[model samples]
Target: MKRWIILDRDGTIIKDKNYLHDPNGAELTEGAADGLRMLAGMGYSFVVLTNQSGIGRGYFTEDEMNAVHLRVDEMLACSGVRVSGWFHCPHRPDEGCSCRKPELGLVRRAQEELGFSDADVAFVMGDKKSDLEMAEALGAPSVLLMTGYGAEEYAKGARGTLNCGNLRDAAKAIAEFEDGAARASFSRDLREHAEVVSAMRSLEAQAGAAASVIISSLRGGGRLFVCGNGGSAADAQHIAAELSGRYLAEREPLDAAALSCNSSALTAIGNDYGFDKIFSRQLEAHGRAGDALLAISTSGNSANVLEAVRAAKKMGIRTIALTGGDGGALAREAGLCVCVPSSATPRIQEMHILFGHALCGIVEKTLCR
Candidate 1:
């Protein structure tokens, strides 16, 4: 699925200037935050690609460049947008580094590190000819902005470039493209999964029951507890975010917690006891009667999660398990087990996200009303 849009930093994220390096001086252009907010809402991952030769020319240190990135990250963070990756070519014009813009080296590095396939990218937004040329090499579309050197680049007539007045417009176009694609993909997947609801009747009933329980607790102003490991950790946080706020729909926030959110507690527990006790220990401290624990496990056999489920049960908390095909011990541990009808890891993960999104919608519409 096309899930990412490459961005050129200077004129696209901030105003472009000759040899700009000060983080304190960095300022987001008009609609920059809103544009990013739009892309984020559509689930489009972002990556910034730029040529920062100032480092190689002794004009700025790598540390300064990182600080600039930090400032940018902070600015985006406030709006709930994250840059999945960032890349810069730190070479003089004559250095002939493969990573310099117009070369696919930096793009290749990002592809490898970020696991982005060129075939799946939708567009590259930039204010320069080099950015367009790079997008061409990767078979991705291009969006040209008329900011900074954009006028000069526009004057040169970049073939196939979608011209925009500023980054905000470009971002809007990109978000629309991504949203359309996501909806299409999601619809197709859901349709295919729908055919199996009859075969997985028991699991569906359990999921419905668990979702009803979640809606009840949330309606009563009780918080939810989520926990998992690795990718499931990300999923745990994701589900909680969707509950604590809106996923795509506008509604009042729900109270939710991911025991894994506190790094200090996790590290302390891991160090003092063991990895298996990290989540259970947190559950002991935070859980209360009637609170719900949403444990996510692809294999449904993660010992740490099983222990946490046990702890939550002991505390009289409602238990829900989001698991994959043939749920292991997690199915037994959970008061309600929603086993996604897939065994393949990727498909299971895909279903998990879809389920979480639907659950968020269900809980919000039911409780907020």
Candidate 2:
């Protein structure tokens, strides 16, 4: 759903001028255009409602007012801000017209045309008390800007969305309010993760099997090597750290290292044998019959990770894979593979860390004791 902003034109958007008529005189208030663009990016659309007494008072023609509005729109277009509706109450205050500020005529008319109701309005904003009054009529929130005649209203103790200094400040205030509202409620993101993990219960047997492979390799005085690419690469180093540092124990640190941790070797090998050989070349120099290599890839098909798995096997080193979905070629090639049920990369990565933690806990209990 599109969030809507009920806005006053002159003082709220452009510098308020006395009977603004000339298109050339239509200048945007400082930071107003940028703020509108920011709000627009956040899914807020605008409908400009203004009181133009200059037309009724014979100060400017209706055609002249439209020309000026067109000019303002041109300037706003440079910043990618498009006002959805343009409305003006061309009557003097003494005329007692229903379309003027503090009245609901124009706003109601906009609702009819724009397919929005008072409840759909996000906030009403202007540099005048009448603008806030418009919001009060709709029972919506309001923002009082410190531009144009707003200073006078502020001096008179008129409060809005906390007396914004500019449109930029007003936009920031609205965003902060939204963020606070979101934080106060339960997010759907945690629910998504819960669903992914709930589905992973079926992987229990596979995870236990993968953990057993690593434990047996370590128990025989064999080191564990881990490697991946991108986020998985970070996960590799993280898993290695848990094994090498201390996983809830005072025992000696396990012989575990992330092959990608050595930048010098990675770059030299990558430069010589190519990017595909970086992990495989590192495994060649370190792998033994008892050592185990943990290859992690969200897609289960990373070329470099596959190369590393193949090289570990050729050197008589045990291979274990952490992957997702159909488990790709790595699943079939590795000695053991724990595949996450989800096909989404983010969920797969999350499960990888969870499995990594489980492995750390399992091996620490057996090896440290």
Model 1 agreement with the true structure over 1-369: per-residue lDDT tens digits: 647889889988888867788898888876778888887777778899889999999999989998989998999899888998889999999999899998989888888998889886877888889988988998888888887777788888764357887767877766676678799999977776665444455555665687898887776767799999988999899999987867766777789988888999999999999999999998888778888999999999999999999998999889999999889899899988899887767777767777787787777777766
The lDDT for every candidate, in the order shown, is 0.84, 0.90
TM-score of each: 0.49, 0.60
Indicate the TM-score of model 1: 0.49
Model 2 spans > 4 angstroms off? 1-12, 15-186
Clashes in model 1: which pairs? none
Per-candidate alpha-carbon RMSD to the true structure:
13.1, 10.4
lDDT of 2 by residue, 274-319 (tens): 9999999988888888899999999889999999999998888889
For residue 220, give model 2's deviation from the true position in Å.
1.5
